[model samples]
Target: MHRSGSTTHSLFLSPQHPHSERTKRRPGLSAFLCFLAVLAVSLSPVPGAAADHRRPAPPPAVTAEGLRVLPAVAPVMSCGDVTGVDLRRAAGAEVTITSAVVVSENTPNPYCEVRGTIAPANTIVVQLPLEGWTQRYLQTGCGGLCGNASINYGQAAECPVVEDGTVASATTDMGHQGQNDGSWAAGNPQAQIDFAYRGVHVTALTAKALITKFYGRSPAYSYFTGCSDGGREALMEAQRFPDDFDGIAAGAPANNMAVQNTYHHAWNVLANKDADGNDILLAGKLPLIHDAVLTACDTLDGLADGVLDDPRACGFDPASLICAAGQDPAACLSAAEADVVRKLHDGAVDDKGRRLEPEISHEWGSELAWTLFVPVAQGDPVSSEQFALSYLRYLADPNNPRPDFELTDLEFTKEAFWETMQSSSYMSAMDPDLGAFKRSGGKLLLWHGWNDHHISPQSTLAYYDAVRGTMGKHAVNDFARLFMFPGVEHCSGGEGPDSFDVLTPVMAWVESGRAPASIIASKIETADDGAETVSRTRPVYPYPAVARYDGSGSTDDAANFASYTPKREIGPDYKWLGSRLYSSDYQTWCRAEGTELVCGQHRGGRNWLSREAGR
Candidate 1:
């Protein structure tokens, strides 16, 4: 997977390069000096003091018509004393406390870090603030195979509770400690069950138990946030465990796992190969395709901002990029290369042209990130090849593992497509019925990058449309919203403002009953001296509405933009072989029984072989 190292900065426009009249006013020298003096006093460490127990002031309230603020609670137990508390029987699963100590190094505030493992093998780490605890619990999702215990708060950079370290946070390694490859699931039914949905549920329960024990009260609000595979985990929570979190932010989710790995990713690589087994399209021609796409579609939204606001409306054909006779081969693609490019963008298709996955394979502006599937050198394996091969060998068919499966063995026909989706209910999270979550007052904020290289942005759109179809549009609108970042890639980083705070809007929506109208996303550039400054700002609106530039102000300023409905409407349900999986009837509940895992309808007498063969 690709990643960006850009530091998340303040959302406000920079004073050095003011964009409009709405830019924040710069502070005078006297006021700045006074603020620095106050900050120095507050941060100054006490001599011979073991710990600093002072709490920082909470941020301003979000005022609205029906605003309800979640209260903050102080810790009742000392940081060091937390290590002595026993919870072997308190948590639903058997628990072990490996270590508990107060940590203040390289953090905004002091907190007690608790590291432990749950029953079987679910490693978890929880952080409880020693002071200024806002009765809120946040659990982050993991990416890839999620075999390492870690916590990331990048998605919540704008939330004051996370920025000030006033919120309790925790994360888990799913189950089994191994490399990101699917080998962790081979011959292990319990670990597969844990990774599918049980791991997150158990971890949430255990973390809340610890928070209550340390604070003498349960948290008032809880939230979950993640992107990529983490995004899949976020949706799994909403579908499987509706009562777990009050709010969820899922970004570029990989929810349709079975088809994504078996066909979508495999097709990305196989489609680019010629009959001679030579690579048809190389990495060098990506820029040529991307530039052509921008020239054709960048201004579709009434602004020339190097991004396509709605790529589905862009009808750029790859045949136009085909090289003419005696033209420079270095600058243009050959006919064969152009066809390969067309196949990649068209997504996985059967002999009759039916889609294997939903919608387009990859968006137009995302050609640059196609390096994930396109190889720079002949005979070199791409990232998608490895991802697909791994899943096929281990996680695809849990009951009948194919440890020696190769990428060449995959088939893309209608029959083969149904074969791949036989066990989809086990790992995929494409369930569209979120009625339980909506009834529980849980708000879902779904976002995806239009230029994501790994997962197609259209997949997210397909799922969102399915949700709206399952639940009435008006009912879904009150509890769910989708924001599509124009030029952003998988999770973050691309040609647009990729850094934004989704947590703040979700928190406001969950606690104050105020739905988000728009979110400000920023692109921060870091200088050589470690100083950070905002270079660009844009306001992204909910789906079906896009940011339109006011003709008078700078296009770089968010204040110069307003949400406008698009002229074209998104299509109905995607024409895919696995589209039936979107229905609730395809959902399955699995549990480990001795050495075998049983699913619904065939649990009593039928075995995995008979069920799969009959399908």
Candidate 2:
């Protein structure tokens, strides 16, 4: 079929309520007669029709009740007909059908795009192909407090994948509209719920029902995929609603939502500031740190290409970079500058000397990117400043504007720490155990860049280890696997090879039972003419297994490397507060695994909302 131009528009609000007008439209006289004639013959009694198991079933009809009939080769639904289709309540949500049309953006297939808003402020969009459907439904998740339904699932820059024209896709606007604004959650209980979890769950159920109506049968398999905030959503689907998807691919997940945003982001900003309150970490200093790290640890895995194969094994000390006697200011860090590096390696800690978060030591390569979150020059608010400000002012305290926030304003008292933890509990996806998800026969694939500057990759490792501790390593590995790229940053580009396909492997595992042992990742070099060439390729193994070189072969080729399991290191516990909020299922799983320490004991606590709003 010929492709059409891309189309997009907001949904049209009808005067009548959606639920009150479900399928009340009637076909014209000619179309009604035709439908009646077909219905009569289909309903006519056949000789032993119920017992005729050998007889072939009639050809599937391309039309359904309450749907405007169209040829399979034509647009899936007319704009006029789409606005008229009634969207009744599903999963206790009343959704308004706002806009619908067919979109074709230089693809082999055209698709019907449907946009709607679930009551209480959540928007969802679903796209179904007109032809070449593989009988599969794919729901894409959002990124970083999503306020818009970015249709960025199939061809995201971080983990680009070949799109299957037969697979349908959908996305949601996670409750509100702001590109990094957290003030929308203020005093809106239902909206907070929608952003945290309801938005995705309700969107999936609605999309699946719509797919059944359009294609005349339910999809054979369902899948979910996203990175960053989308990655958190993927884990949420597996943890909170296990039966929604058959497989999930999560990349660089911000799963520890509460702690990562408030505690971790604040810690990074403060660490970069000088004693005089100036942003001393300049862009010019990044290369020096990166080079020092590479000089010290690049050959740990038998290569010297400037990328750390496994940075956790590298024990580089920033104290070594302290300026010696008669050193140039440009070449070496002064005592004050060196202190910034030390705090970055040390991470967050309370006054009592207990660690609140793990150190992000692998961020040396992407130190320049850290400037985005924090101010690089005077008068510029750090990137995390606004996000943390909104979270604290609106979600944590409605009365105070919190206008005079300084880098030193963040304190780690137990009262303030628990306040941050308890306030955002309704919106986090930090639970570790996946017993219900595993029981549902779901498969999950997770990946993270080691040099990720946005969310520390170490946090992901901690969660993975917690999962192993809670459910046993073998049991967790059977249903979920995590792959780490050596120098990749925050789900996308870095010094190491980052581009790879997670969708194909997850699909194969779900449909054909082929679990991926090691997926080959490639870094493509694009020429001036836009011609792409694969410059490097490496096999990324599951967690705990590092890729080691064989004796004497082309180092660039993946065939020269083998998977080797490294010895686990015993480190200090971070004692993150969010881990104590898992459901009873996780507690039960920990008990069954003979790890009672994994179960959460502090189940009782003071209500966060009971405090003064101005605090």
Candidate 3:
């Protein structure tokens, strides 16, 4: 591992340093202070706790092979005793255990909170239950250009194991400490590699070693869960480190990173701007557009619910929303605004109209979340611009970084599209082959909100189709299943039942060989006094099959819905400039040589199609 110009000093204090040595000598005083800090963290209210709470529905009990119950016993050594467990030789790097304390305040059970760092950087936090250990381990992934260390299981709130705090969990900062800006990647190939895939894998190895030391054994089952960038990490684990986990739950993954940040997200803002730099579509008109779309296609699944079962089936043309002569601007869109909406839905294109990404960018019911790209006020930069500009400046081309790159320098032409794909092998997780993972008995539960405003749900659909094509549908079905949430937004939002649990289902599938047919999703409402209640519930089926109203009960209940497969297929092979990169041949294995990063094709083969296929 090359360490020149490393940010490790600024991010983490070396365990051998005087500051750490001094703290270790005064364990009594340090323990009390650390207890207070952990108490505050345990007591702090989680954001969106009321609105996002999933009503507890315990998974069916199962007695599967390899299931082990940890003996009921207290720690053989004191909490502070683990600080002396040197792991440098075992980890193949400098592993520092900064603090170890028992945290019980406002928690389901007392647990040991261990904080540490891997050589160079990579901060990690692992929580081991003090009492009942089910021999289960859960490692979470971070979002965006992860610069912060935090543990979030928002996607697995309904799982009894996680809610009860019996399962051990861990998370890492991906080797840097900063804001979401891509500044950490500049002049640092090691940090970039950690952020891409190494951080999560190293964290797993370190955490497992610690777990074995603490419990006298290793976990019986291991799992990984994340959304957005975390989702990308989940797929990366299955693709590159197949034995790291037994099950994975990925939601709205930004797996098509290189092209997604460069073109898909950039085009969202660039295509909506007029020549004078003013937004062609106003944010104020999104509600009206959403309502019009619902009026035109809401009942396609035989229910007039707020969500569209399949937004791709929606043929609600923007031209239908164009205003007549002298019509109120608030009531209908102008011709230019209508055209902008069309281009957005059609995704990014070259000068000759070749697609840069998948055909669909933003989905039909996702208009309300368009505030991500649609400017709220004149001269204000939209969210997508910041996301795209960061990648273009630091992570787009590994061989040539552009720290001074501006938004205006981004080109939507075919030549510029291939330039972005140059680093896809390192940053993106689009490879479809999961043979190694399947052979290891890993179960994958992939999900994306149909109305996801960030990464296109079509990308997930395309990857799922590719896996089936590569490994054969029957073989893939045994280990993988994709569920598309109709009215949900990126991760969880939009006017739909967004709260659900894939963790419990994946756990069952991996342990008991029982696959999920449908997962019930809920729409929760929080009252002013903080009382949370479920407003609606719907069953979300696997891809291509939708929840249709059964016609005899309340639509708000999941029982009234049944799975129905649609006649029209969702995503065929995408006709795009970077379409050839989806194959395994484009995947790369990268290494650090001196201070620079070098990469070579993992498959060492060429894409069957010409690199400039769409051109």
All candidates' TM-scores?
A: 0.87, 0.80, 0.88
lDDT of 2 by residue, 179-225 (tens): 45666655454555566676787777777777766766666667888
The C-alpha stretches of model 3 lying farther than 4 A from their native spots are 1-74, 568-572, 605-615
Q: Is candidate 2 or candidate 3 better by lDDT?
A: 3
| Each prediction's whole-model lDDT (CA) | 0.76, 0.64, 0.77
lDDT of 3 by residue, 61-175 (tens): 4432112234444455667778888766544568899999888776677788888898778888888888887878898989988887777786675565766678888889998
- Judge candidate 2 against the unseen true structure and give its global Cα lDDT, from 0 to 1: 0.64
Cα lDDT of model 1 by residue, 1-615, tens digit: 001101221121011111111112222222322222122111212122133468545433542311234566888888777767776544456787777778777667778888878878888888898888878889998888788777776556546577667899988888767667888787777788788877877788778878888999887888999998889999998987788889999989999888777798999988998888788898988999999999998888888888888788788899998888999999888999999989999889878887888868899898999999999988887999888988898877787789888877887777666666766567768889899889888999999999999998878888888899999889999999999998999999999888777777777677655677777777767779766667777888889898888887788877788789867775545867667767666656677765566666323322442353355
Worst 10 residues of 2 by lDDT: 1-10
**Among all windows of ten consecutive residues in candidate 3, which has the lowest summed lDDT?**
16-25
Each candidate's clash count: 0, 7, 0
True lDDT of residue 39, candidate 2: 25
Q: Is candidate 1 or candidate 2 better by lDDT?
A: 1
